[model samples]
Target chain A: MEKTARREKNIRRQVLVVDDELVNRRLLGFIVSRDYEVIYAENGIRALELIRKNERLLSLILLDLLMPEMDGYELLEILKADPALKRIPVIVLTSEKTAEVKSLQLGAADFIPKPYDMPEVILARVRRSIELAEDNIIIHETETDVLTGLYTKQFFYQYCRQHDRYCIDMKMDALVLNINRFHLVNELHGREYGNRVLMLLADNIRTLLNETNGLACRCEADSFFIYTPHRDDYGELLAEYAERFRSAIESSRISFRLGIYENVDMSIDIEQRFDRANLACTNRRSTYTSSYAVYDTQLHERELYNEKLISDMDKALEEKQFRVFYQPKYNIKGDKPVLASAEALIRWIHPELGMVSPGAFIPLFEENGLVQKLDHFVWREAAAQIKRWKDKYGRTVPVSVNVSRIDIYDAQLEEKLREIVRSNGLEPNEYLLEITESAYTDNSEQIIDKVNLLRKDGFRVEMDDFGSGYSSLNMLAALPIDALKLDMQFIRTICSSEKDLKMVELVIGIARFLNVPVIAEGVETEEQYLLLKKIGCDIIQGYYFSKPVSPEEFNKLIEAEQKEELLC
Target chain B: MLTIDSLREYGADVDDGMKRCLNNEGFYLDLVKSVIPDTRIAELEAAIADGDLDKAFETAHALKGMYSNLALTPLSAPVTEITELLRSRTQTDYSGLIDTIKKKKAELDSL
Candidate 1:
């Protein structure tokens, strides 16, 4: 029932249309309005305005070049300039066949030749474009910004070299459109409304150009860029197009600020044109925007800094700058001194910046496809730590570690784990593998098979923080897990409310029935521990025992406990 | 860099500490409260103590909320744990759980 509700909630489809001709706009709108909420503009400029207005609801764009205001080329330049809206796949519809070829070269995802074939064909293209746009949105959200839908700065730079190579080879036209004083929007109406502005801007631009040749992207928090190749002498045509684009901005109900780049020195290639426009946009500070500037030389320097950030990030892992820390887990019900089971938390000990948390770097790593390296490092580290403990303690305690969903894609997860186990001279049974419920969703059969294989080898598997994922039953039933870690939230409830206590008690009972032990996490207080004990929780770990400590500190704790026991 | 005996000692201390927490009711309650919201306490307690039908609903909702938060998830882990028990409210294991809770509380009061 819940899944069904979620699916229903996810059904909204938004489409944008940009055209210089009113007839084309109305025709496209009439055809698509039934399936998607369609927004239209007569020129690329007006499309950008609509994009800025309704960014959130937009899914696909049908762009037409040769518009009077902001010709398709200029519109594309503006769209690609902003990283946020750049993912919206454009289907360029232009009468000019030469322009269609140029549009493809300019980074247009698809080009629709002049004149619609049939309504079915148009619908098919629209459907395909929407799918691509939605996929792009998913990619953007998982790895980039949810609001602007831009390639995360980390993701953008990570892909920079390859992207630049592709651009140069294809001679793609690109532009960087920076939104001046976007901080003011965030500062004024707050982030939510500012995001709305970006959405609105992106949606409007998406609709204004020939769908095949144009794209609007959110490049940064405040900056945006669009790129498109010029097939014909669009210099004169673009001047008039810029006016319409400006007028569309002025006509919008919301009081949004604006800027533009058009009619620059046109002799250069597409990338140079984008550069010129960005330069012109930057030079004239006093002119209240809704004014257009053509390409210029200044934009090159601005791009250099981005290139450097990307390059630096690329080398971050190879430099051996990352390290890990362990947090101890305590079990409340055992009436035994809490054993330290370390959660292998990672850190980047950047040479210059001191220390960086996984919270900061992990997301960046995931975006840039560097997470695999980090995962490998973590696995090796955990294995090494466990081995060290086993050599000393003789398998009396366990070490818990995290794994990412992406690691399963490597096809060597089981092999790697086995290798690490064998290399460390450690029994797999002594180490506990902790995984999130989400990981099960990625490749359930493979994950279960591998985990079960590990279990068969005597390794203990614990589904960490079990109560918060989509498929708990499936995970428990399919995988050979030894224990289930109750998330801290379950434990928190026991202290504050009866609702939580009942729940905890129930979980304990169920686990007991299944012959699977339950570990309540985040037991911070004495009362929570008491409640967990009452509920028959097999094990409990939290701050109520002790926070994570260093090996030295942990040794001290053991000595103190022994002394106390002696006194008793 | 570390000695074998010291590592064994560390494991023993952790084991003992974990055992101590198991029999302490107040400790469990406090741990639960710290991690969950305030609004759910009264109803959850009332349901568990009295076995009210409404308590089941309230208990289920609270468990769902708490488990989701702790797990940093929105799915079935913690809530499923409780719901399974709640569904089998008449099971003998449920009684064992309640007795465990009482014993833990007694331990904490003694402390």
Candidate 2:
């Protein structure tokens, strides 16, 4: 019973019957009134007024060609001009065969003969046209984003897949744009304001499109994708777009990062093209000077390398592929060279690539947040080596392992370090912690507190690469550290530039005044070693003494130094 | 009364015409009665007198469709002739065709 009621209600939607003659209007109304709620208009002008008033409730229109004040053609021109009104199908009710053909050419859905001869044929044609129009409205709604009227991501990809040949023939390029820190805009403003901004952006992107061919899509939040014919100079085009965006959201101070991938590999899927362009956009995340990047072969290789490293990292740790190398620091104040301490550095020996430098993998691991695990591994290995040396030689020099910024944030850092020391039967003083100078500059209060906590627990803390960072002098005054390792760049240029030499001397003097020992790293010449020692530097570590060596070689050097001390 | 049988007597295929109207014979009869007095004939004559060939063609064509729908081919044939001539912008005298339509329309109205 409900189904029958719904059917009756569905079929009773208003159908507009327009004719200049009252008799013809009444005739059409009499034929269709049983299935529809018929509305009559004597001329096209009145029909248009009725259509505008009942645009939402109207399902179809039956229009006679010979009307006054506004002809059927004139009314159709107005209706089709409006996006909202065009969804309602208009079927021409004309007596002339020529008018039927001409009406169809002017975007009419179908034609019904006048004089009410074929009531059933007219009804069937009207029903079919309404059904088809409704289906089109549903499809259009699903394929478009309601907020921006831009193609949705799924439809955009499907369109690209279907039109691949068109793109190749046109020499198109794919560009992905991201609003930098857009979430901050939503938080600072409101979500409604963000929606308005997106709508404005969509309008601007539409202006950039070609009339017939190009497409722009809203891929996801704050990201827009476009495919257009390749421009001769994309950098200039992107600059103009960036400037436009900057002006559009002037108060928000928003910027855009655009990544472009020229369509060279036609065989690749459209989604892969978007992925490559997105990867290019991510490459600009850490940079501040530029807002656009084009995907190239070098970045592709680097991306592949990063993927390989991420997949291989766990296996590398389990297989013990990582080795720790120790660079010995000598106590330069003594007449005879004596071992004071060492810095433990990590090295990776890939099964296929031989030895991989820390430069290749450390930054990659740090980005992926896997450096903390590697840091713990290095700490445990260095502590165990120190314990072994103490057991064998009856004495042991403390070795410091480099800790990354990611490790400092770990809540388990203190407990993990203590566990490693206790498990190896080593004293807390036996292992030292070395943190880069720049790490102290980030969240200095927290880093200072952590360092203080570690020092109070008996572990010596040293600042590495001290002179390289901007806030070296300020950190020296603020941090509670035992020693300072001078940056290698300062030491390397000291022999060449007298100003650098003077800077080095001043640094050592500051360390001395602070009652902290100073170590100069990367010393390569005898003259540099002599000059550092003469300047009251307490320790030196570089190629001049010895390069970073394997654990066994470092133990042999320590044994040789002990024998030399006995002879002295 | 101008019934379906009367329309059939005037060379109108009432049976096929009724089928086209979804067998609504009363509706078809009412349409014929309504079209007999439509002012479009005067509009067509005025358009021809004004030398507006486009308007003349449109009015004649509309009348032709009305006659054809009722299957009144005898009335529709002469209007179709005038419509085609005006549509093609042909320089020909339409007096003979107009006379023939007048005669047919008088017969249709008499029914």
Candidate 3:
């Protein structure tokens, strides 16, 4: 019954009173203070000051009308004027009961006839005010994202509908900027870095908006919606803003492609506007350009093409539209081949569009968000080929497959690759996962983690396409990889250009120190192959020995190797 | 003379509605914090003090929500009322009930 009694006490109504007159304030203070948490204001000014200072503690105020300097009438006007301060129940306690109606009109809670009200009547009004305040707090929490303190998507929609805030009808230029490949950044760089980037980007956007007289809103995640009211000069403003964004991107050294659309005439709905901008980004990404594009008719066509590509890609995965071709790696130092590791390269034979080079379609697959699936398909296929090579050659020659930066962005990527290899019953040592050097430079730690995970799982990680990008040597020096694949560009020019030869010599020297094998790619001529041999390249792969062959042709090459081995 | 029953009867009609209003204001403030590039919460005070009617009204509208919720219905009206009284920068009414309400508010808090 104690608990029940406490519960009852909690529900019991309470009020708060403020007054300055020692007797008049206390008389009222005393009568109502019993049923409430009685508070005092010695004078009208003190009362206003107290209320202004601690507005939350108040439920109601029994304001006296006649007071020196700041009277009850003045306080009432002020209270009624403030929406938050106005709601506290206030009964005008004054000598003139005849002014009760006027006091009510001035927004008083109630006019208690001045002589002294029955304590019960005063208590009743105070209880009424406290009940109202409690309900308001509950409603506020539902419509917002607590962390970012932004309006939830639900509230955003309401604002859009009622205020024409984001609608085309407003003739405003609202652009939604989504951070490109943010998930990859999150996976490869770590969430803390991703969040820091977001915060910095938000600050920069705000500063830019203020400078350009534009308005920006954080819509969700890394996506921000910006609205500029100056419709007549939007084009000029956008051009100016683009430079700022470009400089910010370069300074941050983060690769991103942006989508922007300006609607001056309020010509479309929010969905269409967002869709067009997304389409523009899709087209821009397909072309591998790190530039922002405004939506146009071409964006719509690009969207359709992207949609078709995604749909076709699902079928492509199942029907084996993809095939693995092996470019043979040569053991040039021994004069004859000591080992021949196959470089796993993919070719797409689209039914309508035959012979799609990976260069032409690989980006589309990545932009259409199918790179992970492609990676999976390639992993399983390459594993099967490795199994076949072991069976035929009686030796498990390791095959290296190039994993796109997109594939490494998933934090679970190692697990996925491990699962596929385990399911295929293939030894991890027989396969190498090659990731480009540029992939690690922007997000070194994340790539390091990925490489560490793969190495722990007994797979060799090769830094592929090395020496062609800004991050190549730095990453090679930093990352824990077993091998480095020198880009064909360096190898191709080694014989023709002294600068290329010097760089190749430097790369080979570094590889020796790191104890990582260096593989020279694109060794097309006898001079290039001999130069790489003299430079101490552990492996060489190019048209000099053989072109990338189909599985059947590779099997034939393996058969020829068997005969050569017998002859040896 | 006020009684518990009388108090209940007086505020029962608008109690929930007032609470809902206050909550809505809190939510708007939260949204402003989230999306505003530089977070312009301090600017709101200057707008109210300087008698910028539009800025003051917008802020009052938000506060009115909270005031209405606490059943401090009278407190919520100042922004709207002052906004009207101060039509422009020079016309504000800085007297009487507004002051009274503030005092009563202090007394209420002490309770």
Candidate 4:
């Protein structure tokens, strides 16, 4: 990287002249200095020191055969062994008649036979060696990625074309492999661990290319493009890659999603073929069951649909087509379930399409970072509603809103939320922030710092979808949250899946120990409600109580509770 | 003043030496005269007299290169012979070769 940074224009080329005798150094230095800046080293040790200091600038080294302490041959051996310094071409300046074979064997670039070159012979050889070595170094640095040793994207595409030239009528597949949630690897583990994962994947990718007669390049961070011979089925191959990768890394948390374009259209450019592959790979997420996806017409249609939705997102927000629905959460511990805070969920009503599921657009928006806009709109709407509900019912019922992973990552999120609360004549505690557990598990320290800051500002943060994460028990105790919302998936099969029920119980126990209430969502059946109530769940929200309804529908539920309280 | 002609009179390869110095005659001649005070010739003599062939080899090796680079063939010729002899760690008398080098260097200095 230092060498890469040193590759700036207008740097004067330098040559290191290593010789014990001052006159010999001066002689070679004079000749080399005509075309390059000259550096003199008295002996092998001094030469190595200068070489290291000026490795990036030195274009050539003029080394004498014999010296005191460390000899020229010894220095040659050391330089040849080193990957960084070896590229600087060395020309042995020796009068020794028999030193030619040995010097050349030790990796001398060119030899300037001594006594004296009548005129420009030595300088000509010096220039030639420097020019050749420089050309080689430039090619090497630009050809491969420094980290993965894979072809750089430009060179990858270049090599792919050359491959076609040699093998006529060769049917190749353009495949792009991407790591899902790769940032989490860098967050959950350290950056070093993340680099190790990339290196491991690259090594396996190299082997795969070798086997399939392919070429691959690391196109971007956590993204690689591979060009290989066409295959009918990539399913088994991707599985094998997954198995090899999982065993190599020893973590299921890290997964690879590969996109493939088989029998590529020879008419299209290499980059465009890979672009389609990348599109196909990203169409489905890592959360999906399949490891690899192949590009097809149907997939292209879905991409067009998604593109349409993405294009209309800004207008939808402006026209107020997105609606905020409130689902009532009940405190189930008392004699009867008491009305508690409700969760604010977004539902979009498109002009063309009557209703779009939150599941459809939320993920799409999250992928492209438009979720923050929708989330902010919801925050403003929900805060204003809380004010209106308080004035109508004469009681302040706090509402919990989804604080997305992206929203929490925003540097000004806390200030934005505080501004919303202040403008609405409500306390920060009246608006709860629901952040997903996966967010905490990804980058605990940074998110914890952000959450602690929000809590310090009197905002109650609840960890949403708690039981679904791969969070360690140690991390659970350290979380700065007011409540834990059990992931709905766990509650959906708690009675059927014994393991799921035990996980829920374990999480609830951990939650109780932390002195925070546990909110159970997706409690649809009576049995789920009774079982959750028996297990000391503090709050419940699902169809068993009420589905996510509009504010007007939710207002009736609040009114019914008001009448009961008045009668009591 | 050591003109290139005067140095050629003492058998130094003044033309070759100047060419090696990028055709600077004054610089090449000045470098040639510097060999008179070089001290390694004397060191080679002393190290050989002390029977330290290892030190003799090192000093002779240095003088061979310096003389060869400056194109002082008279001095370099003897120095190179002694250098190879010492390199083989031969027990021969190096006084003969060392004195020849001193005599050649003194001749060039007198020029």
Candidate 5:
């Protein structure tokens, strides 16, 4: 912002004298000649042309009341209408004392009585009007955003408060409309191009303010905050805005997410209203989901729930409240399903609430970056459980645990997992890692490099939730993985829908080509299990066999596996 | 070679006019001499004859400002009178006032 702040460099002392009479132009010019450089325009037409060229350079305009071609009064009206020229103060040159009132009404800064006579009075009036206009230009720059003529945030907030005085009873909504992934647009097109986009957005915002009668401010760089009387047509308005941006950029990449706190609770602070609206706007900002989100009752409750989860997370982690559970995965290649390995899952047993679903907290933790702590907790706990089973059954049964994208980014992640395995008295193969397929699609080159490093360290990495994202078949070839774990949603309707079953078959075919096993989860019924087994899916984990259960219950399966009757 | 004394005889307020030109007598008389010869004085007469009162008012008003600025009261007085009449497009015998302005202009031109 400091780099972009505009600076005024030139000194302003150029005075324009507009009069048909040479005596008056010479007289006024001579009076101000010592302090200023005078530009002479014999009539209003010539003066206007000079003003257009030297609008910034001019300090003041001394206009005569009458001239041929264009009179001072007509010129005054023209000057008053132009935004750029109107700021330069004009002092009417007149003999008629009665014309003074009309001149003032027509926007004369002051009047200089017609006469070449008083240099002292003439210079003083000229100097005062110029000084006042200069000061006003300075103030104008501060109040307005340099790129957009919209008010700067501080002044915008001030003006919004002022609006309360006039329309206290009107129900207003605070809206925050954001350009999603704007930095990407900047990176793709240069910053100057980005500025043009912002300027166009500001123009659209000006139109919105005109229609709704509100106060708008351009927030830091890529968003705008508008406080206006409640309008229930935001859905249509957002669509219109989206269309405008789409045509402007000539690409569908110009998407926006608008959040509104409708009929705002005035009891709350204004900033907080915008904060809630901003929260709603960013609800799925990272994902290509909804275009607009209102901060409604449900979203408000969810906000509170997320807040509570954040507050209680640290305490829960320290208190051993998170318990790791294992869902048994059986090798389906044989006649009888034999227990192969278990997938580690977590269940939060809150002291007060008794049982908090992982669905309720995992996403919250993942978004806020507390998932790394929870992931580390599950990693260590699952390793210890594997050791416990090895001690009892005398076999190193492998257990796959989730490795989040955050963990893959962690430089210490491989070392941490190896340390867990070493401390648990197990091999790297005994402690498998499950990396989500979607995480591979983002930062593929980097995550692939890290996964290759981990694979070199002798860890088997399974691509978890294989069909969940835009995993191009080309990308699958790039991912360094030991197995493909079919996303459970694919299995939900596999028996009913031929497309889903064929999709699963296609994935299994790809797995076979890669020469890796396919582990299908969420196979709940016999029909789904038989169909998956027929498709050459090497493993299965679902309620048909067992839901994720306590290690104590899983120990029973381990005992059965030791006796060679795991599941029959 | 219009001196301040001659300008005063032509009914110019030399002291006030001098004060306006930063008390410079040379500049004040120069302005008075310049005011009498302004071509708009001729334009004002032409516009009056043509019945273009708007154009007449513009020219008369300009003469009023110039004569009044130099404090050439004899010329300024009649110009101002006709200027006011032309201001509202008041149709009247502006000829008498125009003649008086012309006579004062000749008096100033002679000075």
Candidate 6:
């Protein structure tokens, strides 16, 4: 009894009874109102008004065909035309069999003849129609996002899964769009405004995809994913969408980064396809020139390489696979070259891969925030070698170690360096610090402050890779440094081109005037070495003298140089 | 006086008609009385005079449905003929069929 009452209460069958004749309306009302709440409208005009007002409460409409002023047929057309009202099942209560057929063709739910048809028949048809409409509403709610009316992420994945075979047969592409710096926008503007921007973006995406067989979903905050069949003009379509998005959010200046996976493997899950696209998007985030990336085999291979290198870094460090090689700098003022200083470079020898160049892993580590660990290890090892050299030979050449940009932000940098030097019983000035010119790009003021503090504590600071960055000259004037290491590119081309040779001479001349010595690196040939010597460059460190060598070989070289000096 | 037994005595299928009304006798009786007072005959005549075949067909069809619901087959038969003619948009004199419907409706009202 309770279930029956509850079910009846939830039925809510409010039927609209439209007729011109009072007797006809009264008669139908007497029969139907027992089971349903009947709303009477004398004609189609009044029926339309009631429909608009009580659209939500109304489950079905019982329209009479012979009514005046907007007949039942005309009203049916109007209801069918409206998306909001079209879902309400309309039962045409027409006397004419012809009208019944006509009404059904015009999208009516059912037709009941007038003249007081069986109340049971009317109730049965009405109840079934309402039930079906309610079911549809429930399905619609679950499948769509309330704000954007796009498919929800779960529904989208389900749809893709269901149509996976179709997609593979048709050759489809999946694209993921991510808004750049969306969190910053939310931080600057309120979340409401951010939601408005998202809505506008969704509208633009829908418009762009109107012509294609595509499915779009709001995957997460500020991210939209689309799967579309492969089209010949897919690139053009994306470009157009980018243009539209830029216009829509012009005030916010919100831009989208898109990643597209065109070569889809049917065997993989749809989420995996989206992951590949997202990976491609992340790869292009730092680039300013392009707003999109296409996932390919090469990018996948590079990603694998990065993963392997990151995983192997700690093991490589623990095993002491990393060795410090010293490249000696020569002071060429006299006929016999004198060893002035050496730069400490780190070399990695992987057990399986043999020699892994610094270029391959250094940038990778820096990106993953692991380069700082490598930097500290190199610093400590180099300091220990300096101490060993001083103890064995009674004197040691000053060695400079590279300090990455990430290391410059370390608060204990100065303290760490002082500790390392003091533990070795060497003056801070005896150990040189080589900072790249590009490291000044990040927080130049802080870097300059740190450099000044290091110099005040008696450590020699050399600006490495001069002329390689855009603002090298500007930094040179403001930076307090002991020397400038000219980039190898300048030395490499100096022998081939007079223009390069002139540029090198000009740099050397400027360094001399500033009372800072210049060390020319990458001097592989005798001709390049003679050019540097003639230009009065203070130090020459390149392949011509010696490549970076192991600590024992470096010690032998230094001893040999001492013997040669004694002979002279 | 329009009782179910009396309807059956007048050759009306009261059982079928009552079943169509979900076996509610009161509601079925109301439907039968409602048809007795209908103005469909006059409406059908005026529609024919105005040459509005759509409206004519509508009124004729309404009369047919009312007679059929009460199981007044004789009254419903002539109306059905005229309704179909109007539905096909064929120009023909409907006066004879309209007269027969009036006679039969009066007979049903008396019963």
The best candidate by lDDT is 4
Off by over 4 Å in 3: A1-307, A472-475, B1-111
TM-score of each: 0.40, 0.62, 0.42, 0.48, 0.50, 0.57
Please state every model's RMSD to the true fold in angstroms: 46.1, 8.0, 20.1, 17.8, 12.1, 9.3
Q: Clash pairs of candidate 5?
A: A115-B69, A117-B20, A117-B21, A118-B20
What tens digits encode model 4's per-residue C-alpha lDDT throughout A287-404? 5343888889577777787888899999999899999999999999899999889999999899997799998889999998999999999999999999999999988778888888
Clash counts per candidate, in order, are 142, 0, 76, 0, 4, 1
Ranking by DockQ: 5, 4, 2, 6, 3, 1
Please give, for residues A1-568, the per-residue lDDT of candidate 5 as tens digits.
1311222243437889988878878877778886788999998899999999998788889898767788899999999999988999999977678889999999999997755436766776777787788788887888789888888888887887788777889999999988878898799988987888888888888899998898898878988899989999988887787778778866656767899989987777778888888888877464453288888868688778778878998999899889999999999998989888999999999887788899999998889889999999999999999899888877877999999888888999889988999998888988889999889988899999999999988899999998998888898877789999999999998988999989999999999889999999998999989988888899999999999999999888777666665443
Q: Rank all candidate structures by their TM-score, best first, as comma-separated numbers.
A: 2, 6, 5, 4, 3, 1
Using Cα atoms, each model's DockQ against the true complex is 0.00, 0.28, 0.02, 0.40, 0.42, 0.24
> Which candidate comes out best when scored by TM-score?
2
Better of 3 and 6 by TM-score: 6
Best by DockQ: 5
| Candidate 5's iRMSD | 2.4
The digit string of per-residue lDDT tens for model 1 on A176-278 reads 5554466775787778776766776665545543553544456567666554443333343334444544565443223322233443333454445545555
Model 3 Cα shift for residue A10 (angstroms)? 59
Lowest summed lDDT across 10 adjacent residues in model 4 chain A is found at A1-10
Which regions of candidate 4 are displaced past 4 Å?
A: A1-14, A33-37, A49-60, A80-89, A104-107, A116-149, A161-173, A179-200, A210-213, A229-233, A244-269, A272-287, A291-568, B38-64, B74-106
Query: Against the true structure, candidate 1 has what lDDT?
Result: 0.60
Residue range with the least summed lDDT across 10 consecutive positions in model 2 chain A: A1-10
Model 2 TM-score, all chains together: 0.62
- Model 5 chain A lDDT-worst window of ten: A1-10
